[model samples]
Target: MTVRTLFDRCRAFQARMPLAGFFSHSTAAVLHGLSLPKALEGDSRVHVSVVAPTRAPRGEGVVGHRVDARPSVVLVADLQVANPVAAWCQTTA
Candidate 1:
């Protein structure tokens, strides 16, 4: 998906989440202004992660992850996004 489309979707998804979760993986990487491989850059899904005990979000166009530990989060363009280190680690997993 185009970055603009992904960002618009991200905002909509964030508004629907009941509890706190942060954008992670490729989604967060984009929020952090990092370059991604072309394949990942083109992906349409947004990666959203919540610490365990809070059920991960489910919906179309979203990839949800339940993490055992709370990842560091930061605000990016008014959206909650995983910190750079956390986002990078999530990508590797």
Candidate 2:
């Protein structure tokens, strides 16, 4: 019950993976658990596709990614739902 509650109350979860930088995109994915496939793993900077107003990539305790109230998914709780693009199952897989 504790574990479930812990999980339920949680939103985004990012480990301090000892990475070089905690820039914008990576920060969002790390804290939010959203995957950044197109990004290089070691860029030490964040790069999201959306151009947000008041978006700044630097902050204290945040090595790279900076999070704010935006339309995109900003937490782990967000992953349960699918994105706008339909994810098709590949028969080949």
Could you say which candidate leads in lDDT?
1
Candidate 1 lDDT tens digits, 32-91: 877776667676689998888888888888888888987778998889899998887666
Runs in model 2 lying further than 4 Å from the true structure: 1-24, 46-69, 72-93
- Give every collision pair in model 1: 1-42
lDDT of 2 by residue, 1-93 (tens): 132332332222234222222223333334344443553334333233222343433333333232333332322443321122211110011
State the weakest 10-residue window (summed lDDT) of model 1: 35-44
Q: What's the TM-score of each model vs. the native?
A: 0.87, 0.26
Q: TM-score for model 2?
A: 0.26
Q: Lowest-scoring 10 consecutive residues by lDDT in candidate 2? A: 84-93
State residue 93's C-alpha deviation in candidate 2, in Å.
Answer: 25
